[model samples]
Structures are given as structure tokens and as C-alpha cells.
Target: MELTSTKQRRAAALAIGAASVLLALFVDEPYVLLVAVAVICICIGWEAGLVAVASAGLLSSVILFSLESGAIGGAVRLAVFVVAALALWFVIKIFRTMSFYDRVYQGAGPNIADIPGLGWSAYPDGRLRFVNPAALEYVGVTADEMRRIMDGDDYHWTQFVHPDDVEASMARWHHNLETGEPVIDEQRVRRFDGTYRWFRDTAVASRDEHGRITGWYGQMEDIDDQKKAETALRERERELRLLVDTVPTMIWLMTPAGLPYYFNKRFLDWAGIDAVKEEPRGTRQFASHVELFHPDDRAAVKAVFEKSFARGEPLQHKGRLCRKDGKYRWIDSRFEPLRDEDGTILRWYGVNFDIDDEVRAQESLRLADERLARALRAASLSELSVSIAHELNQPLQAVVANAGAFQRWLTADPPNFNHASRVAQKIIRNADAAAQVVARIRALFSKTEGAPHAIDLNVVIREVCDLLGDTLTSSGVKLDLHLDPRLPATTADQVQMEQVVLNLVRNGIEAMQNVSINVRSLRIVSRHQNDGTVEVEVRDRGRGFSNPERIFEAFYTTKPDGMGMGLAICRSIIEAHYGRLWAENVETGGASITFSIPIRAADSIHTITAATADSRMGAFRD
Candidate 1:
């Protein structure tokens, strides 16, 4: 049983027994109250706490006085004694606490006042110089009884010191006298009856000016609770370690300063350090474990770490790590900077993922895509030349017709007036439209590029839609346009953007190839957002896109007898202009190809990139 608990139970029993006996006596013969008074005196030392021992003694004296004065209410008087004893305990507890600070500064090191809580302890040397009032209360004795024990006693002091600590305490005293040093140990102390309490003893010998040893000073603290907690912690560690060591992936924990505190056994085996169960020396630090990385990949990996140190950002990168057998493998490492409540970096923690297989697969796919792109571009210039000629024929014919009309007007006695001027304007507009198409093709083949400039959205729409206007009419396809008059200009390559619109229109027309004439229609719409973005949407009344997510994959096509590069190039051009391009099946019926470009002024005079400029979101909002 716990020593404190046993002491408290005994104190309770004594209180009840004394109250019962005093009540029976006073109720029968009033003179017997005098005898019951002696029992109170015997129990006076029960409150042997350093702070309340004196107060308990004084209150016990009151009960004795009451009995001498011929008081018949002995039990009620003792109830008053308990209340008065508590009042005195508080007063002395506060006084003792204050005196403790005073004594600490006066070179009388800590004494009983050093212990503020009600815990058990006894004088180890067959004497009671300072017993806390709480210790007295624990043993069915009162403060007056405790003072008598302090002044002089045999049975009381004998029952206090446990048998186990008596010899150790004696040996420590002699050792302190001989060596002039303190002795510290943990042992059991005897309670009032037969119980033992756990305690941690601290004793030191005083020194003189000449370095000579004087009398020893000491304290014994209760440690049963601390001992129990330590035992529980050890058991928990075993369970946690068993789980960590058996995980499929090797795990490690490192300090923010790059020190590794733990590495499971699997991690040790993976690193090829079989001689030691674990590399205790290397496990303690990040730098110590650097030798495990492939030397060639170290510089780049080190630079990636600057984000955490210099910018206070997270550190994340995939780098090669060397195994014990000198074979280097890749590991995806991620470290996040930790900060204190005040926003100061406290440390960084990290994790690693083995992504070697994923990395190899991506590299393989990249090579295959590059080869396919090369094969597609290897198309014959002779064949392209024929197609270009066929496309250029109609514009040439219009030019010829406009010239003929002008000549006829010149030959007329009276000119055809506005007819010649309008014909000449048409000639110029058609020539510009043909030139813009050629320019788009040339720009697409350029090696270097520039940021998009402000372009009139309506002008692009009208010219391309008008060029395809005749084709749609002849193909029995209906067209609808909803253009915003005050729509803001877009920052995009004009001819490239036009080609995108034209391509979508062509695809829409193709989807309606076998549809009823009434259903074979395309609608183009434009709207200006409050945020400086203009959206262009091409809606068709026919078939929808298949697998929208995969549709944007390079070379993934929806059309047969088509290069499939057209829509891909359109997507690239739209994205390059800091615009978004996507196709989704509209809930109504068909697919909608919607794209949007920022319509704001250029962010800066210098060339700008996504990384170097205000983001698209900011740019559009601004």
C-alpha cells in the first residue's frame, strides 16, 4: 500500500475513534471528559507538518483546557478543535513559506519548509528535528505530540525511520564527515506504524573558510509517483519502436539543426552499415549523413535548400542518394521550415519518397513524345506548298476582280462613284487577312518569343469568322455571333488567336457534317469580365469532345485524317499568351471550346514571365 494513503487512513481512524469515545463518556459521566482529553493530547502530534505542527499543538492545548474547565461537550469541543486547528495551519503555512525564503538566503539551506505539499517523510537519524505538520497528520498524531517527538522521544522516533534506510542514512552521515561532500540516494522511510514510504534523500556537508567539513544538511523528497511514471514511459517506447522498425519504408527523425535522433534498424540495413546495429555517430546529424548522397547531385540539391534558409520557404527536391554498395538512387526529399509563435524559424523537418521508378517512366515517355513530334514535322514541303497554293487562290481571284472593277470604273464616262472606293477597300482588307494567316504560320516556327500585346478581339473574330463565313453558308451551316461592343482588348498574338478561332469553327463545322441542316450550326460569343479578362467561347450544336481530361494530351486526337497537332498548337499558343484554353461538353448539347486572355496593360516595360511578373490572377484583377 502507498505510505501516504496508509497514513491518511490511520489518521481518519484515530479521529473517528477519539470522537466516538469522547461522545460516549461525556454523554454518561461528565467527569470522564478529562480522560478523553488525554486522548486528544496523545493525538496532538498527528499534524507534524513543518508549517502546522506548532498550530496543532496549540489547538490541542485548547481542548485540554476545555476538559480541565469541566466542559461536558467533549466531542463538540473537539469538532471546534479541528476547525481551530485548520485556521492555525493556514496562518503557520504562510508564515513558514515566508521564513523559508528568508532562511534560504541566510545560509541555512532548505529545510521542511522546502516541501510545500502534504507528503510523507520522517527523520532518518533516530531524531525529529523538523517534521512537517502534514507528516504528523498522516500518522494519527497531533502537532503537540509531534513537538514532544522533536524535544525527546523513543517509540515515536523509532516507529518513524524505516528499517531499510537507517543503515544507509548512518553510512551517508559518516561518509559526509570523512569526504566533506554530499550524499544522495533513494530509499524507503518508515511511517508511524509498520508502513514504508519512498523518498529521495539529499544531504550536503558544510565547509569552513579553510575548506574543512562541518555538519551535514539534507532533504528527503517523495519519489513514488515519479518512479511509476518512468516505468510507464519505458513500456510505451518498446511498443512504438516495434511499429517503427517494421514499417516497409525506412524512417528517420532529424533535429532542425541537422541532427538525426533516431533511425530504425531497417534504415541501417538499407544504408549497408551491418557492422553496427545503427550508426550512432552519423545518426545524430544531417551533415554526418551527407556521405550517403551521390557526390555529383550534391550541388544542385544544396542550392534547392537555400529556399528554407534564405527565403524562409519550404525545402523540397528530388535528388540522388548513394547506397552502401556505391549505387546511386533517387529519393524525393521534402523539408518544411518550422517557425515559433513569433514567426521565427525554429527548425526544419523532412521526409523522403523513393520515386526512381516514376522518374524513369516519365523520361521514357518524354523521349517517345519527342520522336513522334519529329516524325510529324517531317511532312513534305512540296505537299504543304500545294495546299498553300490552293488556299491562296481565292484571295488572288478577289484581287483580280477588284482591279477589274476599278479599271471598268476608270473607263466609264461617269465613274461608278462609291462602288470603286468600296471595291478598293475590300481589296485591301482581303490582302491583310491573307497576310495575317501567313504571319501566324511564320511566328509559330520562330525560336524566340515575346509576351502578348493588346489586341482588338472583335477585329480578330470578324476577319476569321468572315473568311469562314462563305464556307459555312455554302456548307449549309448556320452561324450566330454575340460580340460585346465594349469588350476590352486582349493581350495575345492576334494572328495566332485568330487561327485558334478559325480551327474551332472548322472543327464545329466538321462535327455537323452529317447532322440535319437545322442542327448544323456554330455560335461564337465574347464577354468582358470586370476583372480585365475577355473570354471567347465557340459553341457547336453537334458531337462533343471525348475524354476531356485526356483531350489535351499531346497527339491525342479526335479527328481522323488530321495531324492532331493543330489543336495542340492552338493550346500551346493560347497558354503562351498568358491565356487559358479548354474544351468541355456543354450540358445543353454539344462541346464548347472556351479560352480567355488578360485584357490589362502590360505589367512592366521590360519583358515579363509568369515567375517574374504579377501573376495572371493579379494581372487580370489589377
Candidate 2:
């Protein structure tokens, strides 16, 4: 809508006059009043372009009072300038077909205060700048407080650093001087209110064209949380030592490779020391412990260790560590490799227990087993001797009978060569039978080399059942298998599984020792669950679990001779397979021991991977 004549121009003048009244009354800036008059004149350009000067003169009548005498207040001045620019714009847009109000009102100004997560710092030359606002907030201060801190003439940066770390900072500063390298240290820095907290600071040498050092550009960040955790760990170590000392056993902590980390007070006593002091440390942790092992057992110990240490054998057995005493003592020890979140071995922590009595018992049992085997062999040989005697008697008797036949044949002058050949063949067969018996006895006693491969839980169960097929039948225990058909194979040596399953089923048989002949049952079941895992549940009926949770704890058991390690071993196996194992009472009767293994997918299941940028199905750009 354009103004077509002087009448319209007069109408625009009235509007400016009204705005001027408002500027003098509610508003403070006279410039806004002048801007309104100028806008009226500009709009009337087609009719009063020559008389625009008079309108400009008329714009001077608005301002009466102000925050600034002869000048506008900061707030009023800013608004006035803004309004004037908008009024000029409004006049220009009136010539266009569309309204300018829509565009002008839609756009909003940027917020300088909320620039976001930005910190500010200034050089020594009084440039007020934003340092790490994060560090500022962490130190519990505001930007204004920071300004006061930098300007404070009394306090230096190191004055805020913790006293304990001050020496380290000084050392770093000296090193930076010599090497011309950046000085970085984690220490405490002072706050504006004179409190100290953890701060990580770095000072890098700034160089010019000539390569001379200008000034250092420094950065300080708070690391109080990390420092607090470190302090907690230090305290924890002391507490752990105190706890180990309280235990009666010769408790020694070791690395996976039999290296000594440290020993408790009990271990120190066993080693003939009063109390192990800090630097002499009684034993430098790790590799050093290996040097203290009994000379004769070292090779055997290291070989057994290599099986699990070098190549991770699912932690299976715990054995002895001979102490400071020359006499060999059985110490139940286990190694658990300390791996990182990515499964890389960072270190290991293990414990050793005094199991000298248990070792003696095992040795005694082994000797007894050998003696029993010998006695069985003797009995079997005695039975064989009786058979041999019978065979010899029959031959001697047959020879006597055949002597007359031979004489008859000789008299007839036709030799019975076919009969002689048949006798020779029979003698050869009898000799071979004796040799086979001897071989069977030798095989039963001889040491066997290991045959190992990846094991499937389903296959393992079947094999165990098959191996004990006759034993189960004789014991009157029926084994019912409900195995999952599609269990993914595990990277395990089948021999280990053989040992574990054999032990478990044998334990099951022993568990059911109290079951009457009318109700003997052992069930081995396996299935792939909804969580994409394969599970094996071994259930038996006899006496129910006392405490299923406690059963798997090392050195916990009901049986007198039961090497409390069976359930513990099962748990270790399950965990090594990156699985879980636990025991729970069945509703009907008895207890069920269950183990589950993750079904390894075709690829790793991380949100991102090395090839993720090229992923066929994703929004990640390369």
C-alpha cells in the first residue's frame, strides 16, 4: 500500500507525532522519535520527497529526560538504535508487495552468555578471556572469581598445588627447562577463595621465527575425582594386607607366572621373617616369587603354569606352593589372570593356601590305587595261570592219546602231515592269546598322551554317558539326556571337559549314594536358551542341596574326602567359556547344577568397529 498524495503524507506525520509522544513518555531515547519521523517522510517520498527536510527538523522535539544527560542510558540507547533501524526497514518494506513485520519479528538474536561448554583464559597481559569453564566450575568458582584469581598479586599457581605434589611439580619444571619440552603435571591448584583441589596443568614453550622460547602457554584442569579413586586404592591395599594377616593360613598373593607380589604376615612368619617391610618388601611382587619356589618342583611348576599362563587354560586346578621351609608343604594355589575390558591380560592375582595335609592324603590315595591295581593284576594273572595249567594238561593228555595214533600212522607208512599242521596252528593261537593278555594289563597301567580338541557340551555329555554306560547300569542309576542339538562348539580341549564331566557325573553318583534302589535317578540335560546361549543342567535325586550357592565356593563341601574343588572347577570352566554356572534345588527333589555358554555370533557385537564407516546398513559416514 503506497501513499498516493500529500493527504496521506499528512496522515504519516500524525503517526510519527504519536510515536514521539510515546518516546518522550514511556521510552528514553530521542533517537527513536527522530527515526519514526524519518520513516514517515521516507514513506511520503512520491508526494513529499522535497519536503523530507522539514520532517527531519520536526524529529528533534521528542526527548525531555534521560539516564545520561545529553546522552542516552546504555539500555535505552541500545533499544533506541534497534527501533530506529527497524522503523527504517518498515518504511522500505512498505514499497514491497509483502509485509516486513513477519521477517523482522521472526529472527532472534544470538545468546553470547550460553556459548556452551567453552572455557576462557587470558595471557598475562590482562586480556579477559574464557578459560576452561569446565575447570572453572570444577574448582567451584565463577568467571568473575577467576578474573580475581589471575589478578591477585599475592598467590602463585604452585601456591595452590598440594604440598605432597609440589616437589614433583618443581622437578617437572626443571626438566622442562633442560629439555625445552612441555611441562605437564597432575597436582592441586588454588581457587579464588583460597582452597586447593586436584588440577592437571601443562606449560608448553612457545617459539617464534628464530626458535627462541617466548612464553609458556599453560593449561590447568581439575582431576580431583581420579585422585580420590587413587587414594582409595592405596587405602584398599593396606586393608587387604591387614585382612590377609588376620587369616591363619600362609596367605601369599602371586602373579599368574608364579611371581611373588607380596605375602601377608602369616606368609612372612612362614618365611622366618617378623614382618615384611616396605622396600625390601620381603618379596618384590611377581617374577621374583618364581625364584623362591623349591628347586626340584620349579620345572614341573612352570610347565603346569605355562598351560594356563601363556595359553589361557580355563582355570582348572589349584595346587601347592612350598614356603620358606625346606620341607615341601602342599599349598592350594590358583591363578586368575587379570585381563582388561578388551580381554587383554594386564596382570594376575592369585592366592596360595596351606594344604600340606591334603597333599599327603592324595599321595597316600595314589599309592593305594597303584597297590590295588597291582593286586587286581595279580588276581587276573592267577586266573590266567589256572587256564594255562588246564591248557597244558589237556595238551599233555592229548599227546599221550595221540602217541598211539602216531605209532599207528608210522606203521601204516603214510605220514599224517595234515594233523600235524593243524596242531601247529592251534599252538600259535594259544601263544598269541597270552601275549594279548599281557598287552591289556600293560595298557591299563601305562601313561597316556593327551588327545585334545574343541568340545561341544552336547557331545561331551553323550561321550561321558557312553564311557560310563556299563558303570551306570551296574549302579542302577538311569541317565536321561535332553541335550541341545545345535550347540556351537567351544574352544576347549576335550580332555578338560572329559575330566570335568567325569568328575561331575561321578559326583552325581556319589551324591545319590543315599537313594534307595527303588528311586535312583541322574538327569543330564542341555538346551539353547532364548538368550542365545547353550545351557547344561545336571540334576540328581538323593539328598537335596544344603546351600546351593555355597557348594561352588572353594573348599566348601559335605563329603569328608570330597576335594571341595569339583564345583569350584565347574564354575571356573563356565566362566572361562565366558559363561555362568550356579546350583539350585529342583522343585521335585535333589539339586540341579547348571552351566551356560554364550552363543558367539558371527561377528563382534559392538555399536562400532573398524569397518563401521563402510557398514552396509548404518547412518555413519565414512
Candidate 3:
């Protein structure tokens, strides 16, 4: 389509040239040809105009020669005409070029109006040459006013910049202009409404063929919304940072590789001035940070952290941390990984909570418990000694009475031999009985057993209940006996078996001390198992053991003043009789402690008793 337009323009120029030539030939007018040449230049460009001038000069020469003029005179006149046409072409070309450039410089061209944002141009000397219509409208100024402002001073644009930003903006602009570098800056500019909004101004120098800057063309982009968003984001970040710093607990942030990067205000304060300064950069590494833990805990804490980091797992560790005051306090530190959508670790966030008070309280309670246990043990030993003394007193008193009777018989006026012999026999019997009682006491203390005997567990339970009847009444506890009348007696140490029942019954009664009176019932059940064993169970309606298995451990107790030895001793006695003792929490309520011992035949009782005694002795030695 452009080719067609060019052809048409050339055709019009040729037609005008032809008409002018014909008019000149007929009217003999040179002024008409000059006018035609000027018309071609303006309409069809300078090349077409020059072609027309050449054709006119040749035709004028022909006319001069046909009129009987000399060839030299005709040639000279043609050359003068050609020279004049050439001069006219040069002047017209120069005028067109200047007019086009002037329109562009003034931002009067249609293309300049189509440009988005505020378009501008400046001379090489950093003087504003033109501001586009959009730019003039944005600044709320007319073309004439802007032109005046631009001409008024080199820093004329500073008037539109924010007051606080003017100095920095001017400095940057001048520096870039002097260095002939690209202009890039962000500053707040006044809008048409007299409100300042952020804008980014960028420009590059337009260089000529010699690499010298001719002008600077640039654009101003409205970045008000962007700047506002950035400012708001920064404000939110500041608030978050403040919150983290002011939190009571210590907080820290680390890289995925476990390098500490940030510590909150609490952490810095606790770590002291040296930490605040981040002196010795290595202190931020995992190993270096672990050094802050108590020497005894450093290795374990480091290992935990390293393992957690390598596996991208959360970690919790309780250890002592060295404070700035040179005191070590218990700190519970927890670390968790921040992960992305793909389950990749991005960072680690950690918190350290001071648990020194809780730890110290626990330690103090443990020490108090140990002291109480020792006191209870002493009291128990003293009680056992009194019981032993009471047992010996019976036998000793019997012996004294029998000895006085024998002495009286022997000292009688006439010696009563039969009566004296009978009295002496009684004294000997009492002495043997006293010896047996002493041996039994030794066996009990040594955790050894005497000869096995056939004894009904129901009888033992009844004896224990009778002994604790007063205690049960005082504590408001009811006793429920579930004895199997048909149950066969088991062969075991009668005394040790009685002791087991006694301990279990007491434990059950004590366990119910806190229970309501209506429900504070201690039940003792005895049954003959099909597996040739006798089972005894002590059940109570009370708070169950927290850890049923741990209750049987030596020195473990729930009561404030308990020695924690009752269950232990009971278990040992049962085990010595080749029995199994276990405890369990009842689903309905409370707990149950049960022991089962084998029912051996009467003939094997002696062998079993000897083996049991040996077992008990070995256990004690160990």
C-alpha cells in the first residue's frame, strides 16, 4: 500500500513538471518553472524537485538555441538555472528537517501524545527541552508555563519533587548528568492534586555518531501504590520483630543447616553484652552454641541437635544453661523446622523456657522424700525390735516361773524328786521354745525361711485381719473376706506367708484411707487354682497406683511418710516361697495386688523348703 502511495506521488510530481514545461514553452516564463520546482519539493520530496529543475534547465537551453542564440550563451544560462534550482532544493530540505525536529523537541507530535506515563526530553546540558502533554497535565501546568520554568533554572524540576526528597534527588540527577550515565532514581513527585506520590524516573543519554550525548530522553512512572505496599510490608515486619523481642521466653532463628542467624531481645539479654555484639562469630554454630550448656550436658545436647537437624525433625531437650551471672539454670529448649510445601526444611525456630524453679523444687522434694524414707525405716526397725522383745518376754517369763518352781521343789524339806524332775522338764521346754523364737526372728530379718508347713491362707488372712482390726476401725476401713472353704492348704513357710498377708492387708487398708467411708472396703480373696496353686488377692477401693509396676520397686512410694519397703518385702517373701506377685489397676476402681504360690505335696515340702532357704540366702548375698 505504501508503494502505491509513493508511485502516485511521483506521478503527480511528473505531471506538474510536464505542465510547467509546456506553459514555459508557450508563455516564455521562467518564474512559472521556479514555482513548479518549489511545489514538487514540498509535495514529492527534494529528489523529485531536483529532477524537475534539471528538465527545466535543459528545455530552457533548447529554447535559447532554437531562437538563434549562441550555444555557449544558452549553456551558461542553463548552468545558472541548474545552480539556482540546486540552491533552492538545499534550502527547502534544510527547512523541512528543522521543522520536523522542532515538532519532536516540543512534544507536539502525535506519537509523543500516545506515549504512556509522563514523557520528557532534555538537552545535553541537562536543560528540559520538552514535557509531553501527559507530563504537563500531571504536573498541572501549561506548555508555556513549563517552558518558562525549564528556562528559569537548571534545577527547575525540583519544584515538583517532595520537599524532603529534593536535595537527594537533585544530587543524584546532577551526578548522573555530569557522568553522562543513565538516570535512575526514585522520589516522591507532586501530583496534579498537590499530593506527593512516589515515582521512579529513568533516562538514558542519546548519543550521536561521535558517541557524544546529544540529549536525554526519559519517563516518569507512577509508583505510589507500589511504594505504599512496600512501606506497609516493612511496618508489619517491624511489628513482628518487636513482638518477638519483647516475649518473655528466649527465641532464636537458625538456617536449615543449624547455624544461628537471629536471637530475640530476651536471648541477647540473658547471654549478656558479649552475645549482643556477636563476638567470635563461631559462637553462632551448633557446636559453639552447645558450649553454653552445662559441661555435663553439652555433649548430649549437641548430639540431639545434630540428629534433629540431619533428619529435619523437631527436638526437645532439658538441660542447664550458663547464665551471664555465671550461674547455671535449667532450661527447656525446643526446636522445630519450618518446612515448605514439598516437605523441605527452610529454617529452624527455637524457644528456650526457664524451668530452673521447677527442677529445683523437684530436687528438693526428692531429697525430702529420701529423708522421710530413712526416718520411716528407723521407726520400722524400732517397732520390729519391740515385737521381738515381746516374743522373748513370754518365753523368758515361762522359763523364770518354771525355774522357781523347780528350785522350790528341790529346796523343800524332803526332796520331791518327781515334782522337781517335772519342773526341770518344763524349764528345759521353755528354753527350747525361746531359742526357736530367736531363730525365727533371725530368719525374718535375713529374708530366709524356716521349714515349710501346711497352712491355710484363709487362716493367715483371718489372723492378719484380727491383728489390724483396731487399725481398720480407727481408719474407718471395712474388711471383706472371700475365703474358699474347700481350698487346700499350700506348703510354704507359715511365718513368711503370714507376713506377706499382713503387708498386703495393711497396704490395702492404707490405700483406702482417702476413699469415702462407704467405699473404703479392703477385700482379701483366697482361691485354689486348677493349676495346683493357691492365689491370694488384696483388693482396695482407692486411688490406683500411677505406675503399677514401679510401685514394687525398692524405695518407691506414694505416701508422704512411707518407707516404700512394705511391697518390696512382701514381694521378696512371696518369691522365696516360689510364688509370683503382681499388681494391676481395676477397671471399675482402685487396684489389686495378687500373689500365687504352688501347692506342693506334703512329702516334697522338706526339699522345697531347703531349696527356698538357699534361694533367699543367695538373693540376700547378691
C-alpha lDDT score of every prediction, in listed order: 0.61, 0.57, 0.77
* lDDT tens digits, residue span 63-126, model 2: 3333546545544654554455455545554642122222112111223223243223223222
Cα distance off (Å), candidate 3, residue 170: 1.2
Please estimate how well model 2 matches the true structure, expressed as its whole-model Cα lDDT: 0.57
lDDT of 3 by residue, 525-581 (tens): 999999989999999999998999888765578889764655765676677677899
**Cα distance off (Å), candidate 1, residue 235:** 8.5
TM-score list, all predictions:
0.46, 0.31, 0.57
TM-score of 1: 0.46
Worst 10 residues of 1 by lDDT: 613-622
Error of 3 at 385 (Å): 2.6
Candidate 3: 10-residue stretch with minimal lDDT:
613-622
Scored against the true structure, residue 551 in model 1 reaches a CA lDDT of: 64
Which tens-of-lDDT digit does each residue in 1-622 have in candidate 1? 4422334544764676467456644554332333233333333432344233344445454545555565556556555655555554555556544443343322244454445433323232323334455555546576545545544543345456677677776676556556656667777766567577777867655568977554445556778788878889887888888887787665666555555666676776677755455556335545556667778876676666644557767767778877667777788877676788998766665666677788889999999877775555454344344434533555566577677877788678888867888878878976875775565445434432445577788888887777666678888888889999998775555656766787778778887876778877788999988777898998988878778776654445666755344465556656656678898998978888888877657553123233212222121111
Candidate 1: regions farther than 4 A off: 1-248, 251-263, 272-287, 296-319, 332-436, 448-455, 464-469, 477-482, 488-494, 504-513, 518-524, 537-569, 582-594, 600-622
Model 2, 207: alpha-carbon shift in Å? 1.8
State the TM-score for model 2.
Answer: 0.31
